[model samples]
Every structure is written in structure tokens, then in C-alpha cells.
Target: MSMSTLLAIMGLLLSAIPAATFLRNLPLFLFQPCKANHAGNVKVSVLIPARNEEESITECVESVLKSRNVEIEVVVLDDHSADATADRVAEIAASDSRVRCVNGKPLPENWNGKQYACYQLAAEAGFHWLLFLDADVRLSDTAVSNLVQRMQRTNVALLSSFPHQETGTILEKLLIPLMHYVLLGFLPFARMRMSKSPAYAAGCGQLFLTKKGDYKSAGTHEAIRSSRHDGLKLPRIYRKANLATDVIDGSDLARCRMYRSGGEVIRGLLKNATEGIASPVLIVPFSMLFIGANVVPIVALVLAIIAKSTLGIVVATAAVFVSLLPRVMAARSLKQPWIGVVLHSLSIVIFIAIQWIALAQQLIGRRTAWRGRVS
Candidate 1:
């Protein structure tokens, strides 16, 4: 085949893989299970691990306090915050009987700060059902109730939902939606549900719900004490211990702006990289997949147009369409910004670059820092 033809074919293959996977997973993601009918209220301990989260703690606690049809005690672990994170929680606690702030113990040797805080919170929890929520996450009045009902209906040991990502800045709009794209485009929902394989494990760290017994049996945050990506590691640990975990669409129920400024966005993603796509085993293959799927098709289309190759244009056009369809559909489903859909390819390039940079930093004995702690 000629150069243009070869490039076109390569682009088609790269684009088709994720397109097919996204199509397979989209329906499953959109299929929110029917809420199981119950008589009593869902009694859950809403656990929040906050380290320098003063700005978000009050809102987080208030949102949980607003939860309807659920009997919940909100426990906020103030993890050695230099700021007023604990004071904010305390302020909320003073007005509400269900809210209390706990002082986190000193960080143990070789433990991730967040994980250590979560472990402490889990130990202090009084309820059977536990929901580990981040300070930045805001839930609708019915979110906890719906989560409990859905978990009861599905009968899974752990249930997680990637909340509706709220973005504000231009960089945030361009990048944050890729979280959904990566998830739906790669993970096969049918296989994930059918198999308890650790390889199929996936989740969002911002929101996780599980029975206290199951969490303890699976080793909880203690199992992933040193790991930064609890979402991935915790799910894998549960699966390894022969427990089933599942995810649902949580757009209407919960939302979080994970990072505020562009700089924060970069650092937050970097902090998560080594545990995720930036790892030694995954970095290279994922780099190629990300580039080929997101970049090559656009480049091929440009080249084909310049060269006036009809066959090239046709194939590259199909490839571009195949590549963008998933992002367009996901943006609509997840209520993400349209700018991300438009800048999909560019976002992938920047994202992949960050992954490589993270890997390099790791190799050089450098670690990610967030909330005044290093990972």
C-alpha cells in the first residue's frame, strides 16, 4: 500500500478499537438499575478524609446533611491540615447532631496520607454501610439513598460511581472529560460485571460505597496503604479477595470539580499517574494506544486532504469520525463541556505527555506532592 493508504488503514484500526469498546460499554453505563424497595432508611456513615480542604469541607458536610431517605452520620477526618479544615467541619458539627470531626492520627511510616486517614475513619465508623467521599464531592439529596437502593438491587460488595465532573477554566474544560472517555472506551462493562478478575477492576476514588464487613475483609485502605490510586487498587483488592464490585452512572446524583486551576489539574493528574497509566508496564503500550487512537487519525486526515488522495481522505474521514463519536456521545451522556469534545485529540496528546513525564520523574526518585505531602 502507498504511504497515505498505510497511514489511513493504521488510523482506522486505532480509532475503531476504542469506538467499539465505547459502544459496548455506553448502554451498560446508561442503564441505571432500578432502586430496590425498602421499608427502613439506609443507614450509612459518610466518611470524608480531608487534608487542607477547608474551602470544601462545609459544603461537603452540608450536602450530606441534606441527604433524604437516609439515616447518615457524617464523619470528617481532619488529616493534619495546616488550614482550617477541621474548624470548618467542627463548625458544621456544632449545628448538626449527625456531623462530627475527628482528628487524624499521625501518619504511619510508608502509608499514603489519604489512605491512612480513610483507615482511621473506617475504624471509627458506627454503621454497617460506609460511603467514602472526598471533600470536593457534592451529592444530591437522594444520592446516598439511591446508592444504597441500587447496591441492594445489584448485590455487589462495592459500588463506585465516577461523579459528574464539573470544570470551569479552559484547561479544565479541555481535559477533565477525558476521564469518562478513558473509562468507557477501555473497560468492558459486561466482562467487568461477569468476572471477578482483578484485571477488570476500576472505580473513582471520589465516591465509593461498601459494607463495613466486606471492606474490612477485603483489607480496605490498609490493603492499599501506600498506593495513590485507591479507586483502581481498592477494587482490585476486593476482586482478589473474591468480592464483586460494580460502577454506575452518577452524573445526576453527585458532582465534583477535582481541580480548580490549570496548574492544580496538571498536578492532580500527575499524582495519580504512576499508579495508573504512567506505570512501567502500562506506560509504553498506553502511550502508543493513546497517540494512535487520538493523534494519528487527525494527522492522517490533514495529510490526506493536502495530498488530494480520495482513498486516503475517505479512510481517514471514517477514522476521524470513529475517533470522535465516542467523545461526543460521552460528553452528552456525562454532561461534560463541548470544548473537550472539540479538543479531544489535543487533550490526549497533553495527557499522554504528562504520563510520560510522571514516569520519568518516578525513575529519577521524584514523587508527586499534594496537600503538603509527597506520594
Candidate 2:
């Protein structure tokens, strides 16, 4: 086979792998596991680890207070913020009996700040079910109630869901939606649901639900104290302890604008990179798959047209279709911007670039800092 034909074949195969996974997982991704017939009577402690979240603290607390059909107490652990995060929580506490603000203890040696705050919050919680929610995430009125119902029904030890990512800037539109694409495209939802293996464990740290007893037994945040990416870490910890961890659809139930600007988005992703796809073992393989599947086909298609290679054109066209369709479907289902659909390939290029950059930083012993803390 000609080199052009060989490249086209490679692209077609690589693109089809993720396309198949996306198709198989699309229904599971879009399904609202939070919507159910039974209203939750479960009492849950909604724990928020706040550091410099003054702007969103009130809104986050108020939204949780709006949760219906469930008994919930909102606990905001102020992680020694430079802002008015504690004051805002205190104001809410004064008005509402269910809301309380607690000052977080000093960071322990080798512990990630957020993880320590969560450990403290878990200690203060006065309920059987504990929910570790991010301060920026705003839950719908029925979100907590329905989430509990689903967790109880499934009998999973830990449950998490990716909230609706609200993006406004051009860079945000291009980058944030890739989270869903990477997740639904690569991770097999069926295997994740059927196994307690740490290999299949996946979650979102923004929202985690677990029974208090299970969390204590699993060692919770203390087990992964130094790790920044709790989404993957916490789930693996649970699975390693012979417990099941599952991810559900939260796009309809909660919304969060993770980063305010493009710079923040880059830094935030960099901070999360080491524990995810940016490691030495995973980076090269992912780089090959990402470039082969998304970039090669488009370039080969144009070259084939220029050279009039019919075989190259046929396989390259199939590759392009298979690679692009998953993004289109995800955009529609997740309510992502249309811009991501038009520039899917470029987005992958930038996404992979960030991963490699993160890996380089990790190797050199340089750490990315966030919220006045270094990781």
C-alpha cells in the first residue's frame, strides 16, 4: 500500500475505536439518573470546601438550601481564604439553621489543601450520607433529592456526576467540552457499572456522594491526601476497598463555570493533568491516538484529492466522519457550543498539547499552583 493509503487506514482504525465507544456510551451519558419516581427522604450533609470562593459561596449555599424532598445541612469549610468566603457563609448560617460555616484547620504535611478541607468537613458532618460539593456548582431544586434516590437504588458505595459545564469565552467553548468527549469516548460505561475494579473507576470531584460509614472505612480524602485529582483518585480508592463507584448524568441537575478566563482554564487543566492523561505512561499512547484519529485523516484527505488517490480518499473520508460525529453528538447532548463541533480537530490538538506540557512540568519537578496553593 502507498504511504498515503497506509496513513488513511491507520486514521480510519483509530477514529473508529472511540466512535464505537461513544456510540455505546451515549445513552448512559445523556440519561438523567437523577430523575426518579421516589422522592429522597435521605439526610445528607452537603460539604463545600471553600477557599477564595467569596463570589460563589452565597449562591452555592442558597442553591443547596433550595433542595427539596430531602433533609440536608450545608457545611462550608473555609480553607483560610484571603477573601470573605467565611463571612458569606456565616451570614447564611445566621439566617438559616441548616447552614453552618467552619474554619478549616492548617494544612497537614504532604496533603492537598482541598483534600484536607474535605477531611475536616467529613468530621463535622452530622448525617449518614455525605456529599462533597464544589463551591462553584449550583444545584437545581430537585438535584440532591433525586441523586440520593438513584444512589440508594443502585446501592453503590460512591457516586459522582459531571455537572453542566457553563462556558462563555471562545477558549472555554473549545476546551471544556472536550471533558465529555474524552470521557464518553474512551471510558466504557458498561464495564464501569459492572465492576468494582479500580481500573474502571471514574468520577467527578465537583460532586461526590457516599455513605458516612463507607467513607470512613475507605479512608476517604485522607487516603489520597496529596493527590489533586479526586475525581479519579477517590473512585479508585473506593474500588480498591471492594466497593463500587459510579458516574451518572448531572447535566440537567447542576451547573458550574469552572474557570472565569482562558488563562484560568489552562492553569486549572494543568493542575489536574498529572493524575490524569499527562503521566509518562499514558501521554505518548494518547498522543498517537489523538493525532492519528483526529489530525491525520483530514490532512490525508486533502493530499489524496491533490494526488488523485481514490483509495486514500475513501478511507480518509470514513476516518473524518467517524472522528467528527462523536463531537457533534456530544455537543447536542451536553448543550455545548456549536463552535466545538466546527473545530473538533484543533481542540484535540490543543488538548493534547496541554497534556504534554503538564507532563514536562511534572518531570522537571515544577508544580502548578491554584487558589494560593502549589500542587
Global lDDT of each model? 0.89, 0.90
Per-residue lDDT, model 2, residue 356, is 91
Expressed as tens digits, the lDDT of each residue in 1-375 for candidate 2 is 666788889889999988899999989766464445455468899999999999999999999999988899999999999999999998989889999999988898899999999999999999999999999999999888877887877899998988999998888999998888888889999988898999997889899999999998788899999999999999999999999888877988899999889999899999979799998889999999989999998888888888889998998898899989888888788888889988889999999999999999988998899998994
CA lDDT for candidate 2: 0.90
Question: Candidate 2 — number of clashing residue pairs?
Answer: 0
For candidate 1, write residues 1-375 as lDDT tens digits. Answer: 457667878988988888999999988987353355341556899999999998898888999999877899999999989999988888888889899899999999999999999999999898999999999999988888888887887889999998888899988998888877888999999999999999999999999999999998898898999999998999999999999999878988888989999999899889879988999999999989888888888888888888888988898888888889898898777788888888999999999999999999999999879988894
Per-residue lDDT value at 335 in model 1 = 80
Candidate with top lDDT is 2
CA RMSD of each candidate after superposition: 1.4, 1.3
Steric collisions counted per model: 0, 0
Residue 56 lDDT (model 1)? 90
RMSD of 2: 1.3
Q: Residue 371 lDDT in model 2?
A: 94
